[model samples]
Target: MKKFVLKPKIYFNEGSMEFLKEIKGSCAFIVSDSVMETLGYLQKTIDYLNETGIESAVFKEVRPDPDVKVIAEGMKKYLETQADTIVALGGGSTIDAAKGIIYSLWQFRKAAGEEFKKPLFIAIPSTSGTGSEVTNFSVITAEGEKVCIVDEWMAPDIAILDSTCIQHVPQSVVADTGIDALVHAIEAYVSTEATHCTDALAEKAVQLIFENLKALYNDASNSCARERIQNASCIAGMAFTNAGLGINHSLAHALGGTFHISHGRSNALLLSAVVEYNANLNSNDSRYASEKYARLAAVLQLPARTYREGTINFMQAVKDLLKSLGIPNRVRELGIDKSKFENKVETMVELALHDRCTPTNPRLPSREDLVGIYQKVF
Candidate 1:
């Protein structure tokens, strides 16, 4: 039987950061990179915990992609703080790093036959992408290869979505991350494992992201738009966490890890190519995937009378959206040498094939199929 799951009590709205003030934990270990400190959110989070008399320590060394070696180091710091609460206080990378640290410790303690005190995990997202705040999934990189880790026990106990956290995001970042949420929603909606419940959540998230992302990207100070995108991101996260993702993520992980591209940007670049591949647009007749894409087009109010027409329109719509956001539609625009990328094609295909997200893809891809996708994007 197919089952849907949701977790992590969410606190949102303008002053939702205040939720930390009521947390009953004795100590909080805040995990983030230097950006939070530069933006002064680190101090703000500590102040909220301080109001509740919860002492806190900081681990500020996290980097993007969450290198596996550093995860071990973070575990050392996590233990050193003796924290009962674990607060992830940045974007997806920071949260993923925190998850890596927490999950690693649990595995270590279990293997050693020692007691493991599971901390009450809290995630505060500074970006509207990855939905890492609400999902039991994380991406970790080791030896220039990316791996997705999924475990029910790694989900946060609470998620705080304060408007103040996202109100100052860069417009470019807004575009990239918003598209990341779109990828999650669309992938989940067409996933082989999708259920009625996941479809509902994914559809809502898709609608929200399409409607609000452009506005939010144009004006970072638009609190209403920001909240909508944030909510959409989390909703998409919940949907994919249950419905599962597909080869879009698998390809994205490979692309980002190989080229050092930001995950959001990587996903945005690959989205249209992946959509076309999954929807079977090259075929004359529409099928399940095309029908689903057509339905999503109808939701967006695009002209989609026939399933094939709807699917084509939706693909173009995504391309139009990416263009409006100033995102690069072609991989060459990112300035990666064609020769280098070609050289990495085999490795990318291998990584994508082995990715945890690949199994749930609507279409089972062969080696040549993955190579073709890379070439099309390139």
Candidate 2:
């Protein structure tokens, strides 16, 4: 029988940070990046914890696309602090790093035959991307490859979405991460593992992204838009966590690992091509993905004279969105040498084919198929 699981009680809205005050803990260890510290968000979180009589410590070493070394270091800090509570405050990287640290700590204790109580894991997202707060997936770079680790224990116990913290995010980040949320929704919608539950969340998430992303991108201070997109990100995350992802993520992970492209930007760069590839009616034996794409187009209110037309319109819309956001559509446009990409193309394809996300893709991609897709986008 198929199963669906939900955890991490989510708190959102203007005063959502107050939820921290209610958490039962003596000490809290915060995992975040230097940027969050620079923005004073770290201090703001600590202040909340302090109000609750909870002592706190901060580890501000997380970076974009955090690696195993960073996780190992963070794990060390977690142990040293021995905080009863762990709060991850930042984007995907910070939340993912926090999860990795906690996971590592659990494994170490278990391996040593030592009793360990699970820390109260809380994820406070500073950006409306990745939705790592609600998901068990963590993408850590290891030896120049993005390694996806998923476990029930990795999911945060609480997810606090405070739009106040995200209001000052850069417009470029808004664009990159907004598109990433859209991709998450789309991939989940078309995943072979999708159910009515996942599809409902994915459909709403996609609609919210389409309606609010551009507005947030144009005016970062629009609280309504910001809130919508933030919720959309979490909604999409919930959808993908249950439905599973597809080749879009697999391809993005491989490309990001090899070229050091930012995760959201990498996903945005590959979106149109991946959609077109997935929507191919002639080669794909199954009509399920194509129908799902058509449904998504319908949700966006794009004209759908036929399934193919709807699918094409969806692809064009993605392309248009990328252009408007100043995102490069081709990998070469991002300054990678064409010859070098070609040389690494085979290796990337192999990595993607073996990615955990690939198995759930509606259409099974062949080696040649993946190569062609990469070449076209390159």
- Estimate every model's Cα lDDT from 0 to 1: 0.92, 0.90
What digit string (tens of lDDT, one per residue) describes model 1 on residues 1-378?
788789899998888999998999788999988999999999999999999999989999998888888798898988888899999999999999999999999999999999888899999999999999889898999888898999988999999999789887888889889999999999999999999999999989999988999999888888899999999999999999998999999999999999999888999989998888988877765487899999999999999999889999999999999999999978899899999999999999999999999999999999999999999999
Structural similarity to truth (TM-score) of each candidate: 0.98, 0.98
Q: Write candidate 2's Cα lDDT for 1-378 as tens digits.
A: 667888989999887998888877799999988888889889889999999999998899999888989999998888888899999999999999898888887888899998888899999998897989899999999999998888888999899999998998999999989998999999999998999999999999999998999999999989999999999999999999988999989999999999998889889888888887888767646678878898888999997778888887887877888888889878899889999999999999999999999999988999998999899889
Flag clash pairs in model 1: none
What's model 1's TM-score? 0.98
Model 1, position 336, has a per-residue lDDT of 96
Candidate 2 Cα deviation (angstroms), residue 327? 1.3
lDDT of 1: 0.92
